[model samples]
Target chain A: MAEIAIILLNMASYVLVLVLVALGLVVVFGMMRVINMAHGELFMLGAYTVVWLQAAGAPFWLAVAAAPVVVGAVGLVIEAALIRHIYRRPLDTILATWGLSIALKQAVVLIWGPASHSVAAPMAAAIGVGDVTYPVYRLLLMAVAVAIIAAVFWIFLRTDFGLVARAVIARPDTAAALGIDTRRIYRASFVIGTALAGLAGALVAPLISVDPQMGLGYLIPAFISIMVGGAGPLAGVLVGGGLVGGTNNLATVWLSPVVAQIVVFLLAIVIIRLRPQGLLGGRDGA
Target chain B: MAPRWLAGVVFMALAAFPLLAADYWTGQLTRYLIFGLFAMSLSLVWGRAGILCFGQAMFFGIGGYVMAACTMGLVGGALTSSYLGLAAAVLAAAGFAALLGYFLFLGRGLSGAYLAIVTLAIAYILEQTLKSAYTLGADNGLSGVPPIDLGLFGASVELWQETPRYYLVLAIVAAVYAALDRLLASPFGVVLTAMHGDPRRLAFFGYHVLSLRLIVFVIGAAVAGLAGALFVAVDEFASPTLIGFGLSTEVLIWVALGGKEMLLAAFLGAIAVRLMESTFAELLGDFWILALGLVFMVSVVLLPRGLIATPLGRLTSGRHRDGT
Candidate 1:
C-alpha cells in the first residue's frame, strides 16, 4: 500500500512534467495548426535562460520568472521572421520550424558546449503524504503545474482575448470581418504557446539533465500526448497527458523506461487508429 | 525533372567523373547517387502524391537490415547472393509499407499534419526497437557486410574496387531514375497528381484513392529500400542511423530544399547538400548546420517553389514537361 502511494506520487509528478511541456505544443499545434518543430528547442532555450541566470548568481525563483519573458521575446522574433509568412502551408511550417530547431540547437552548441548542466532544486524539504514522504519541491511542482493549467483554462474560458482567439481559430474570415485582427491573435497565441514551453523547460531544469539536446527527449513524447489527447480542444492536453504520462511512468516503475515509451507509442497508434480525428477533436483537423 | 538531353549530358558527366576524380571521391559519389535515388523516391510520394511520409528512413533501414542479413549469410547459410539480398530488401520494405499504409490511408485516413505525426512516431518506434534488439547488435548495428558480388554462368565479379562499385551503383540508380521519370509521365502519374490536388474530386471520377495511395507508398518504400540495400553494400555495414529520426528528417530537408515537386531537383538537392556538407563540415562544423537551417527556413518561407528547383527550373525551362 505504501509502495502504491509512492508510485502514484511519482506518476503525478511525471504527468505534471508532460503536461507542462505539452502546453505550448497543444496551444500552437492544436489551436494554430502550425507545426512548430522548433518548440522543443524553445523549451531548451527556456532551461538555458535559468541556467545562465542562476550562473550569474540570480535566485532560482527569479530565473524561473524571467523564463516566460525571455522565451516569449524569442518566440516573437521567430514569428515575425519565419512563422508569419507560411501560416497556410502545413508541410512548409514543419520544414521551416525543423530548420529553426536545427539552427537554435546549433546556436546553443556554439554558445555553450554540448554538455549537460544540473540545477539544484530551490527547496529540499520532505512532506509526508499518506505513507509516502515526498519531496516538497516535487509537490510544489505539481501545484505549480496545476495552477498553470487552470490559468490557461480560465484564459480560454473567460477572457476577452481568449474569446477572440477562439473566434480567429474557428473562423478567421468572420473574425477579420468583425475587426478582430486575426494576425495579431495568431502572433499572440504563438508567442504564448512558446513562452509556456520555455516555462515548462525552466521548471524541469532541476529535475532533468539540462543540455542543448534535452528538448529532443521530450519532443516525441509531447507530440504523442498531443496526438493521443486530441489537438482541437484545450482539455485534450489533460486527457492525453494523463494517459501517455501515467502509462509511461507506471510502466517505467514496472518495466524499463524504453519499453514504457514503446508501449505509449503503441497506445497512441491504437487510439489514433480508433479515432483519426482524436478523442476530443472537431472539424477534422486530423 | 531534368530534360532528356540534359539528363543525357549529366549521365555522360557522371560516367566520365571517375576518370578525373580520385578513387575515394568515386566511392563517395556512389553513396551520394544512392542518396539521390532516395530523394527522388521521396519526391514522387511527397511532391507528386502529396503524402508527407516523415518516417521514410524506417523503410530504408529495413532494407539495409534485410540486405545485410541476406548477403552476410545471417538469414540462411547458403543465401549470400547480392541479387537475392537486394530483391529481398525491396520486398521487405514494400511489404512493410503495404501493411502500414493499409491502416494509415484506409478507413478514417489521416492526412497532412496528422499523417506526418503518426509516421514520425512509428519511425521513432522502429529506431528504438532496433536499438534494443541485442541480436541485431543493440544500436551498434550489424557490420562487415560484404560488397555486391555479380555472378555470371561460370565466374563471379566482386565489386572490390571503387570504380567497379561506383559504375554498378550508377547503372542501377540511373535505371531506377529513368523508370520513375517515365512513371511520372504516364497516365498513372496524372491520376496521382489529380488525387494530390483533390482526392475527393478524383474519387468521384471512379479512382480507387486508397489503392493508389498504398501503391505509391509501397513504390516509394521499395525505392528507399533499394537505396538502403545498396547503401549497406557501399558502406559495408548497416547501422541504426539509417532507420531513425535523424536520417528521416535529413532526407526531408533535402527533398524540401530541392523542391518536393521536382524529381531532378530533389535528386540534385541531396547531392548538393552532401557536397556542401563534406566541404563545410570540416571547416565550420556545427555552424554549417546552423547556416543550412537558416537557409532551409528562408527557402521554405520565401521560395516555396524550392531553392534548388527555382534555379533548375530556369535551366530546363523549355525542355521540362508537366510530367517532370
Candidate 2:
C-alpha cells in the first residue's frame, strides 16, 4: 500500500509539473497562433534569473518571486521588437523564434560560462506519507502547480481581461471591430504566458541540474503534454499532462529514462495521427 | 526563374573550385557540396511543397547509419559494397519518410506549426534512441567507415584521394540538381505549385493532394538520404548528430538564409554558411552563434524571400529586372 501510494504521489507531482511547463505554450499557441519556438529558452531564462539574483545575495524565495517579473519584461521586449512583426506568418515565426532560441541559449552560455548550476531547495524538511518520505519541496511544487492552474482558469473564465483575450482568440477581426485593443491583448497574453514558463522553470530548478540545455529536456515533454491534451480547452492541460508525464514517470520506473521519452513521443505521434485536434478537441475555456 | 547560363556558370565554378583551392579546402568543400544537396532536398519539399520539415536530418542520419552498417559488414559481408550501401541508404531514408509522411499527411494532415513540432519530436526521439542503442555504438557512434569503392564487377577502385572524391560528389550533385530542375519544370511541377499556393483549389481541380505531397516528401527524403550516404565517404563516421535537432535546425537556417524559394540559392546557402563558420568561429568563439542567430531572425523578418535569393534573383532572373 505504501509503495502504491508513493508511486501515485510521484506520478501526480510529475504530471502537475508537466502541466505547469506546458500551460504557457498552450495559452500562447492556442490564443495567438504563434509557435514561440524560443519558449524553452524563456524557461531557461527564468531559472537563470533565480541563479543570478541569489548570487547577488537575494533570498531563495525572493529570487524565485522575481523570476516572473524579469522574464515577463524580457518577453515584452521580445514581443515588441521581434514577435510583433510576424504574428500573421506562423512559418516565419517558427524560424524566427528558433533563431531567438539559439541566441538565448548562447547568451546563457556566455553569462553562466556553460557550467551547470544547482539551486538549493528552500525547504530542508521531508513529510512522511507512509514508508517513503516525500521531500517538502516536491509537495509544495504540486500545490503551486494546482493553484496556478486554478488561477489561469479563473482569469480565462471570470475576468474581464480574459473575456477580451478570448474574444481576440476566437475572432481577432471581430474583437477589433468591437473596439477591443487586440494588440494589447496579444502582447499581454504573450507576457503572461512567458511569465508562467519562467515560474515553472524556477520551480524545477531545485529538482534538476540547472543548465542551458535543461530547458530543451523539459521543452519536448511539455510540448508532448500539450499535444496529448489538445490545444483548446483548459481541461486538456491536466488530461494531456497526466498522459504524457505519467507515461514518462512510469516508464522511467519500469524501463529507462531514454525509453520513457521515446515512448511518450511515439504515443504523441500516434495520437496526433488519429486525432489532430487532440483528445479533448479545441473547445476552449474550462 | 534564373537564366540557364547562371546555372552553367555555377556548375563551371564548382568544377574549377578544387583546382583553385588547397587540398584542405577541397576536402571541406566536398562535405559542403553534400550539405548543399541536402539543402536542395529541403528546398524541394519546404520551398515548393510548402512543408516545413524541421527534422530533415533524421532522414539524412538514417542514410548515414545505413551506409555505415552496410559498409562495415554489419549487414552480411557480401553487402559491403559502397554502391549497395548508397542504395540501401536512399531506400531506408525514403521508406522512413514515406511511413512518417503517410501519418503526417493523413486526412487534412498536420501543416505549419503542428507539422514542424511533430517532425522535431521525431528527431528528438531518434536521437535519444541512437544514444541508448549500444549495438550501434551508443553515444560513441560508429566510426571508420571505409571510402567509397568505385568498383565495377570484382575490380575495386577505392575513392581515397581528395580530388577524385570531390569530382565524384560534384558530378552526382550536378546530376541530381539537373533531374530535380527537370522534374520541377514538368506538368507535375505545375500541380505541385498549385497545391503549394492553395491545396484546396488544387483539390477542387481533382488533383490527389495527399499523394502529390507524399511523393514530394519521399523524393526529398531520398535526396537527403543520398547526401547522407555521400557524407560517410567524406567524414568516415556516422554520428547521431547527423539526425538530431542541432543539424536539423542548422540545415533550416541554411535553406532559409539562402532563399528557400530558389534551389540554387539553398545549394549555395549551405556552403556559404559553413564557409562563414570556419572563418569566424575562431574570432567569435561561442558568440558566433549569437551573431548568426540575430542575422537569421533579421533576415526572416525583413527579407522574407531570403538574403541570398533576393540578390541572386535580381542578377539572374528577368522577372526581377525592375528590382521589385
List residue ranges in candidate 1 displaced over 4 A. A129-131, B152-154, B318-324
Q: Against the correct fold, how does model 2 do in TM-score?
A: 0.97
lDDT for each candidate structure: 0.89, 0.89
Worst 10 residues of 1 chain B by lDDT: B315-324
Stretches of candidate 2 off by over 4 Å are: A282-286, B318-324
Q: What is the fnat of candidate 1?
A: 0.88
Q: Compose the digit string of candidate 1's lDDT tens values, residues A15-59.
A: 988888888888888657899889999999999999999999999
* A36-146 per-residue lDDT for model 2 (tens digits): 888899999989988999889999889889998999999999999999999988779899998999999999998897889999889989989557788899899889889
* Candidate 1 residue pairs in backbone clash: none
lDDT of 1 at B52: 95
Hey, what RMSD does candidate 2 come out at?
1.9
Per prediction, the TM-score for chain B is 0.96, 0.97
- Kindly give the stretch of ten consecutive residues in candidate 2 chain B with the minimal lDDT sum: B315-324
Error of 1 at B142 (Å): 0.8
Clashes of each: 0, 0
